[model samples]
Target: MASNTNLTPPRGLEGLDLLASAIIILDDDNRVVYANPAAEHLLESSVKALSQLRFTEMFLNADSLNAVFRQATENLFADWRQDLTLERSGREPLHVHCIVSALDKPGMAILIELRENVQQLKLDREERLLDQSQANKELIRNLAHEIKNPLGGIRGAAQLLELELPERHLKELREYTQVIVKEADRLQTLVDRLLAPHRRPHIVGDVNIHEVFERVRSLITAEFPSGLAIKRDYDLSIPEFRGDKEQLIQAVLNIAHNAAQALAPRIAAGDAQLIFQTRIARQVTLAKVRYRLALDLHIIDNGPGIPPEIQDRIFYPLVSGREGGSGLGLTLAQTFVQQHMGVIECASRPGCTDFRILIPLP
Candidate 1:
């Protein structure tokens, strides 16, 4: 029952939309012609809205864009590269490593490529790392000071309520207090999870990524215990990279856990398979560096899959698709990996979901 409308987009443009990179196309007059999905999201607007604005209207430093636009138009060239700062309303301006080129069959149209602001992105990453470091410390202290006492009280109340009521009524009264006790326990667990990353000391060393994958596989199997398979398609020749082994383990573990959770029903149906794929990528960009070599690790699952509603915000803190999920796992994973100058990206459809992590090789 597939619709045959030929809706599949041209491969290059489609790939651009899926990428975390921002892209914009401009005409000879420097008018906005196209803005990819990432650019639209980054700018907090749509292609339609962006199309109404000139390159100057969107980019705080329009001169560089204008200069390049003129050059491409005058020379009929196919490519240009520069780093420029882009300013959007409300948000602080962003620095972008830009690539521009005239389209083959074009009077004025030019392709615009964007990479994240290296300096700003680096500062933001470090600032968030510091913020998370401090936040976790406060989270631990506050949770210890605040959660434990109330949780004890709630559990105590449930036990006392069971003693006071008649047997039949005891179940109901205990259940009420039990709800409070359970929630408090869940909150305590969540606080611990949030504090875990910050509490650990860095265990820096050369890490074989496949070993990390094997560890994740073992851990996931121990948890799932039934009806799930961890399939590996690895290129074992990838070189060892400098990193915190335990942290990378935790990062990969978190992502695998989410995939396993998503595959729960499929596991029950005996149709679930989660795959670990590793390969070496060349000329790859992560947090904006065009590294000569990068580690490409993929975790793919065949499950019911993630809904589209919250896909864009999946890496944001405290977002989860599961009931009672603390939602801190993926957020923490992203934070941890990003600390090592890496990126984690996800793609999902009806029965398949994939999370890819790319880190520069050292």
Candidate 2:
């Protein structure tokens, strides 16, 4: 014998809280009835704080979202708008996809789902960068091999010609041969460096990012001893991760060295500064993989920032912002970091420049 009473569904929204997309429940009057954890994170407000406000209060242009909500309620179906802008005061407006559906329960008339458009853009950008890096590596390797073969033969021929020249009357001519040999050697070294990242075996070990920073600080201070000040703001709680120690050192050194060169005038005037900051980032997505924890290392410099004209292509091989620069330092640094499953990003202005490195932590 079964009871005649009907069983009611659970009133709490515990299931909605598990979703990565932001979820907001609204009452018939459009006031917020519930907000999940993802919604709290997206709004930068707690669930309790959000519940006190109406849906229209959270955005500058709420009319568009409201229109969709009205249609969904009237039709008794779900509706969604793509690339809708949600404005926040004192912050950049966010582009989000808004989904609205009517709920059958009382006091929860509608369910709204918000997904950030920037996140998809980030994923696409990472995919493009990874593809570009692979193409660059292949091009460099093939080009370097072609150049290397001719280089050895050129040097050998130059030396042989010098030995075969008339000993008594060809001293001045011998100098030309010597010049050819030196130039060939220089080119050979350049080719070797171009292929270095691919040829070198990765050495794995526990790496303290702070240690790498300290090493770079010491080296940079030694070179520009007088004017530049190196500052450290470290989050001591960040645990060590595994990586290639020497490669990390070289990657950071190249970036710091480039900054030092950019700060030449300020360095001479005794006012240059470089800051090394380390912190732990939570819920970060890098190279299409979401990480629970990632190491955020920022290298900040107080100097005339990167010129706006060439800012976009700074990481491309042979694209130097400074005159006489080979433009390979940053390229090599980007390669090394990418090999460690990390990414480097830069933000520059007239007086401040920041290079941020993000690597997942185990």
Candidate 3:
């Protein structure tokens, strides 16, 4: 479809871009004035493509739409809300809860908003994740600290006991003391790793998301030189945001590394594919705070998906899908992202797994 370049985006409507709901504005003649990013995604068309398109030309059936539009414009303050079905490409029907209200603007401006049926459920899940993240952090900190304090004494006691042993029995006793000392040191190291993210100071800098991707890409590509194909579907227009550059790199690398390991079977078949996809999300809400734009970065892999039983607990410490895996990779990644007021979400099935990292854009 050819775009209508003659139509320009309306002024004083920039705030509309910050809305989570899909919004469209129409002129008195029923020509589309503007379509927000959410609206464009809902309609499966861009603002430029939908611009200046007459109401009848845009929809397969315009009778109901016209009636609702008229009902809304008749009374400026009376907003008409109803469930409506829109035909897509003449086959698929999209069900939407639509609200048409009159805008107090020149030329009989009408504002139409479309909302997804599951939007509320999605928001509730996001809220739950944020709350759960907070609780998990506190629990981890207390648990790590509790285990950390006694470790030094246990190791020191083992050394003292070893030195006090008699010469003839020293060889056998030394072996026993060595085990205690080594095990204590191992546990101490584990505790330190658990507390690393929280203990380290966050260093903020202007981070280009693509640079982070490149660093991860280089590491994964070298690790799996053959049989695996790493693909990039990046939106180069994503603006640089303030974050800890190294933290972002580690967060992405952990996800990609997990993907590479899961792709082992596919790798042997020489058909494995890992994709790094990035897009700019408009009007993002994270941890109850809303931002004008956010980064939607996806690490997708065509490998066996996460097991159903442990899918929800993947972010928890010591939860591993692979055998002998420490499972701290994703936990640390989540911590690092959370430090930046961002979140990492996972969606997995049989053939595809998508790990999304969302951060508010600057």
Model 2, span 267-310: residue lDDT tens: 99999999999999999999878999988989999989999998
lDDT of 3 by residue, 244-271 (tens): 9998998999899989999999999999
Off by over 4 Å in 1: 1-184, 222-227, 283-292, 338-341
TM-score of 1: 0.60
lDDT of each: 0.76, 0.85, 0.84
The TM-scores of all predictions, comma-separated, are 0.60, 0.72, 0.67
1-362: candidate 1 lDDT, tens digit per residue: 11111122234556766778877766655666667778777777877777676767775557656777777767656687777667766788777788887764343366677787776676465455446545654655676668667767877776776678787777667778778778878877776776666677777789999999999999999998889988999998898889998889989999999989888888898788999999998887554456899889999999877889988667766789998776778888876787678877788988989998888886
Worst 10 residues of 2 by lDDT: 1-10
State the RMSD for candidate 3: 13.2
Which candidate comes out best when scored by TM-score?
Answer: 2
Q: Which candidate ranks first by lDDT, i.e. highest?
A: 2
